[model samples]
Target chain A: MRYFLELAYRGTHYHGWQRQPNGISVQEVLENALSTILREPTALVGSGRTDTGVHAGQQFAHFDTDLTLPDTLIRSLNGMTPSDIAVYDCFPVAPDDHARFTATYRYYQYQLCRRKDPFRADLAYQFVFPLDVPRMNEAAALLLKHTDFESFSKVKTDVKTFNCRIDVAYWEQHPNGDLTFHVRADRFLRGMVRALVGTLLAVGQGRLSVADFGSIIDARDRKRAGRAAPAEGLSLVGVGYPDSVFTQRTTGPAQAF
Target chain B: MRYFLELAYRGTHYHGWQRQPNGISVQEVLENALSTILREPTALVGSGRTDTGVHAGQQFAHFDTDLTLPDTLIRSLNGMTPSDIAVYDCFPVAPDDHARFTATYRYYQYQLCRRKDPFRADLAYQFVFPLDVPRMNEAAALLLKHTDFESFSKVKTDVKTFNCRIDVAYWEQHPNGDLTFHVRADRFLRGMVRALVGTLLAVGQGRLSVADFGSIIDARDRKRAGRAAPAEGLSLVGVGYPDSVFTQRTTGPAQAF
Candidate 1:
């Protein structure tokens, strides 16, 4: 049977979401816990990889096991996992369900705060400059017009193509003078969201005109784009999946367990 | 001149808000940074002291210095301080202004989340048990009826009296299945808010009744009350003072600096 593991992690301490040889990773921690609990070598196929210092509100992974999972599996996994990682739920899924390829849409948000908030210091980027929200939104709207984001993608990435279908892209301003850029796409290239946010911020600051941003996208050169925003400010907010893939969906009543 | 420094800190690292003989404290770090920047030994009188692992959203401290402060003091202090500590603003205040004694009210919040969230791992306490919000509120309302909360105060405290006037006490529920307890009072004894939250949580869990909570307060003995909630879930949200204390209140335009 195949099981889907819904999880979340603060990537500040780990190298990244994927398994790495140099340092500890969220996947390694989860895999170790799974192996210990199942009494066998276990591996996970994660939905996508998040870079170092990038947080996730919700993430999904898939693993296979021949035995039935105990009712207390989630609690046991959470007990074994580090405090920075949380296992929300584990439920049965179709054997063909793929955590990576079956994902329909991905939502990401990058936070920038003008005021210094000690609580959000690690979660948000402290930007001193005032952002022109309207201007930033105008620049963000341009993203939906184009599918090829070669200029925003990191160089030497292993992805097959730079094409991605952007569903929604906009900048939202909060009451506390914080700006958040929300973007949803079918798929994302390495470092694409952060690069787009950084370049759009330049437009908000009036350093780059909207026309210049358009030209940079047309250039298809990573060097033409601004620097990628810091990873700490970025979060994978949601991953959309088809309803048919989940064999069981556990909601509110599960908390009572 | 006396300067009021508004700051905030994530108390996960240091030994709470006050200077201690053993571990490093937020006050000690701030004092060191101030002394280094001003080239004089400076000590701060904080609005209140938070226990270890307790966060502060907005806290005030006062210190005296003879030299004129540069406009870059906030930026310099932030540069010297750790990432967990943020110096929001520094402004001149009246000589008689006191950070601790003159405060009109203090606001504290305790956060509890049923769902596991990695983003809020350090910010909130995770409890999988279902909470009866209405029952918790019923018990919270009883707090406003009494002034001497000897049951909530930590043992062997140096305070002359256990009296406290609770202005507001309520439990707020969020859409994401998180509950936050907000309490405002003229003053708080050491471990008062945490103990109250813990006892209220017991009432919500049906381990104790609302009447039992009132009896616990009437007992006026710390040993009779529930255990104090963990420090990580509690935060000092705000400290209020009179308008006469400030010589100048800096607001939005300071962001440009």
Candidate 2:
């Protein structure tokens, strides 16, 4: 049977979501813990790979197991996982359900603090200078109108495609002087969100004109883009799937949990 | 010559502001770094000891040196200190000046987050439920009206006294659904702010009556206090000294190398 796990974690301690030989990854730890609990070898695939120090508001992964587990699968996983990692929900899925490919869109949020608050030192990326949120939103809106994101793609990545349809792109201000950039797309290229944030920040700081941002996307040249922002500010917020594919899928009660 | 250094540091990676044997400390690292740069043995005395994972928004320390360094002391110190530790302003002070004793007051901020934003995992302690800010403020107001804070004092601590005059006590909402408890006092006992936040949180959660909070302060017994909040939510925001101390002290501009 196939099962989907809704998860979230503080990525500061792990190497990333993908498995690696040298450092501990979230995937490896979850797989090891699940194998012990189910008493069977299991292979799990995450919906996305978050870089080291990148967080996730909501992340999903799927695995297959022959053992019959209790209905409260999430409770057992939550009890076994480290305090930094939490499993919020788990349920059996259709045998063909895919956590990654079947998703229609994935959303991400990048949090930025404009002041030097000591409490946000390790969490939100602290940028001392003032920001132009309106200009940033304009640049982000232009991003949603484009499809080929080659300029924002990491040059050395092994991904086969650089195309993505961004359905939503905008910036919202929190009362605490934090600016959150929300961007949702059918898919994202490797390092795409971070790179876009870097370019948008350039526009926000008046370094790059919004008109120039459009050409950068049209150029589809990685060298034309600005450097990627640090990973600490990025987070996977939500994932959306086609209604047909996710007919029975529903989030558990979000009323304070 | 005797010198006093005004510095700020993000203490997330540090064991504490003081030298420690368990792991690398902020003071030890600064000592080693400054010693290596100046090629002299330096033993600096700080205003106070900040516990592990506790940040210093404004910290002061004094060091004596037999050799004469450049007048641009901030530049020299910044060149020596790590990125996590920053030296802002430095000046020559009277040999009798004491960082801890000469201080008139010390201010601390305890932050409480109502929700997990994926951006505050390391920087702020995430409290799930909403807190009644106005009630907590009323209880905190009672704290400033009293001198004995035994209910907010940590147990089994080596302190000469638990008496303190709170100059300011208030909790302000930062619009990010996080509350900041700002308190200014002549001095704070060990774990005082965390303990105070614990009790105030209890009041906010309906665990303790707001009217009864005053009696808890008068009780002065550690057993009457609530559990200390996590260290991540606490930060030393400011340290105030007599104006006369900084009057004669001349320092150079802040220029980080």
Candidate 3:
């Protein structure tokens, strides 16, 4: 049976979402915990990969198992896994319903602290310079008009295409005067969101004009974009899937076995 | 001259606010950072000590120094100190003004998570069981009527008195259903906040009635209270001092040296 897991993780300690040899990854720890609880070797496929020090407010994963799952799986999984990761829900999905390929959209947020906040030191990028929020928003609107994001993508990525339909892109000022860049798209290329944030920040700082930002997209070269923002300030905030994917919920009610 | 340093810290890595031989502490780290930046050995006396794993949103400390201080001291101190600790402001105070003894009140907050939150793993205490917030507030209101909090204090402490003037004590439920216990008092006994939270939690859970809680305080014995809540949930959120303490603001405006 195939089951989908809804989870979240603080990615400060993980080497992204994928399994890697050098450092521990969220996928590795989660797989180990699931396998132990299920008493079977379980492998998980995540909705997408998040780089080191990036956080995920919501993420989905799919795993296959042959045994009848316990009703207390969620509670047990939470208890067994480290505190940085939390498994919120688990339910059977259609065997063909893929965690990655079937997702319709992804939303990401990049947080920039206007002041040095000790509580948010690890969670936000500290940028104390005065910013032109109105000007930044003007440049951000340019993102939704462009489909070829090669200029904002990491160089040498394996993806076949750099085209993405950006649905929303804007900078919102929080009550605390911090800024958060909200971007939603059909799909994002590796390092695309951070690169976009970095470039937008340049515009906000008056280092780059709105016309200059538009020209950079037309250039279609990664070198034309600004540096990728730090990973700690970026988070995978949301993932969208078709309603049919969750129509076949099969997990039992939560109860102690 | 005596200067007061306003600071904050995330205490996950430190032993506590006090210097200890066994482990690192916030005070030790701050002192080292100050000593290095000022080019002289310095000592700091904090408003009060926070236990290991307890966070502080706002704390004040006094240090005596003879040399002229730099205008960029706040910025420089922040740059040199660890990310977990931050010095917000520094200004000379009346020589008689003390960080601990001259303080007017202290405010603390205890965060209880209604559900497991990956982002707040180390910042809050997770208690998934259902709670009665109104009942808990009723019990909390009784705190203001009493002066002696011996039942909610650590058994073995060198404090001259256990009497506290609790001005505010209540449980507020956030939009997400998490409960925060906010308490303000003239002074707190050792382990007083955590012990009060634990006993209040018992009231919230219906294990102890509001009348029973009042009786516990009247008993004036530590054994009558519930177990002390974990340190992670408690934070020294605010410290109050007389207005005259800041009348001699001596720190210059923040500027790059």
Candidate 4:
């Protein structure tokens, strides 16, 4: 049997999402907790990996088991893990379900604050200066028309190709003067979101012109892009899956919990 | 001679604002950097100690030095420190000037975000559920009416006294849907802001009534308060000082910085 789990974790404590020898990781902890509950060793496949100190609002993982178990695996696994790590959904999925490959889109967000908000200093990047949001947005519109993002892709990434269909990308300001950059893409190259953010920020700071931004994308050269923003300022907000992956009421009103 | 210097530190990665042998601390690293620059052993007296992962927006400290250095020490010191920490103001004060004793008010702000703002996850406590702001504000008003906040003070704190005058206390909602509780008092017992935030969250969560919040303050027992909110959720927003504490204006215009 195969199952999918919807989860979230604080990335600060983990080196990244993957397992490592020197330190405990989010995946290792989850696997240990879930396997203990299932009474079997399980290697869960995660939607993707996030860098150290990078957080996730929503992530998905899949695991297969030969024995039958009740649907309360989420509740049971949660009881075994720390509060910072949470497992909210657990249900059997189709045999062909792939946590990563089958995902429709992945969403990411970055936060920028003008003042160093004491309560949010760790989470939000405090720029302490005005930004050119209009120019950044005009640059953002360029993302929707492109598919190959070699310029924004990290060099030395293990990704097979530097191709991504960015469905949406835009920058919006919140009332508190906090700025948010939301991006959705069919698939993201390693460090893609952070690189895009860094490039956009150059536009925000007025250091890069929109015309230059468009040309950089056209160059298809990693050296042409700006620096990737720090991992702490980025998050893997969510991944969308087709309704057929899991058999729950696809779009019905489920308990909000 | 002794000089009081107002500064701020990003407490992320630091065990706390104080020196500690177990791990890296803001004070220890800062003192080392300053001592290396000043070419003398340096010890600083901060307004108070902040726990590990806590932040200070405007913290005051006094350091004694036998060597005479120009006010440019501020710029030089900041240049040597990392980006996370900086000296916003540096001034020489009277021999009797003290950072802690002369402080008239210490204002703290507790920030809460409704959505999982990846940008603010480290800086704000993200709670998805709606908070009852009006009830929380009412409870905050009740707090302003009291001098003794034994209910909110952390137990086992080494403060000489728990009684303090709260001149300002209230909760306000920002446009980004982040809630901030601004509190100003003559002084705060250790962990008081986090404790108050936890207590107010109980009211906001509808677990405790607004009336019960009033009674909680009157109880004057640490156990009466709710659990202390996470350390990252609270920030030392500002600290007030008398005009005598500031150095004479060397330049023409007078700015807060």
Docking quality (DockQ) for each candidate? 0.52, 0.11, 0.49, 0.09
| lDDT score for candidate 1 against the true structure | 0.89
Query: DockQ score of candidate 2?
Result: 0.11
Q: What share of the true interface contacts does each candidate keep?
A: 0.62, 0.05, 0.68, 0.00
For model 4 chain B, give the 10-residue run with minimal summed lDDT.
B248-257
- lDDT for each candidate structure: 0.89, 0.80, 0.89, 0.78
Off by over 4 Å in 1: A252-257, B252-257
lDDT of 4 by residue, B142-173 (tens): 88778888888777877777788988888888
The sequence of per-residue lDDT tens digits that candidate 3 reaches over residues A1-257 is: 88899888888889988889999999999999999999888999999999989988888899988899999999999999889888878988888999999999998989998767767787889998989999999999998888999998888789888899999999999766789999999999999999999999899899999999999999999999998989989989888899888786664322110
lDDT of 3 by residue, B1-257 (tens): 99999889888888999999999999999999899988999999999999999999889899999999998898998898888888878988888899999999999999998777877877899999888889999999999899999999887899888889999999989877788899999999999999999999899899999999999999999999999999989889888888888787654422110
CA deviation > 4 Å runs, candidate 3: A248-257, B248-257
- The true-versus-predicted C-alpha distance at residue B94 of model 4, in Å, is 7.8
Computed on C-alpha atoms, the DockQ of candidate 1 is 0.52
What is candidate 4's lDDT per residue for A35-133, written digit by digit as tens? 888888999898988877777778888889898876666667767877567765777788889897788988888877664443444456767667889
Candidate 4 lDDT for residue B255: 19
User: Best by DockQ, which number?
Assistant: 1
Pairs that collide in candidate 4 are: A119-B123, A120-B123, A123-B119
TM-score (C-alpha) between model 2 and the true structure: 0.71
Q: Which candidate order results from sorting by DockQ in descending order?
A: 1, 3, 2, 4
Q: By TM-score, is 1 or 2 better?
A: 1
Per-prediction TM-score to the true structure, in the order listed: 0.94, 0.71, 0.94, 0.69
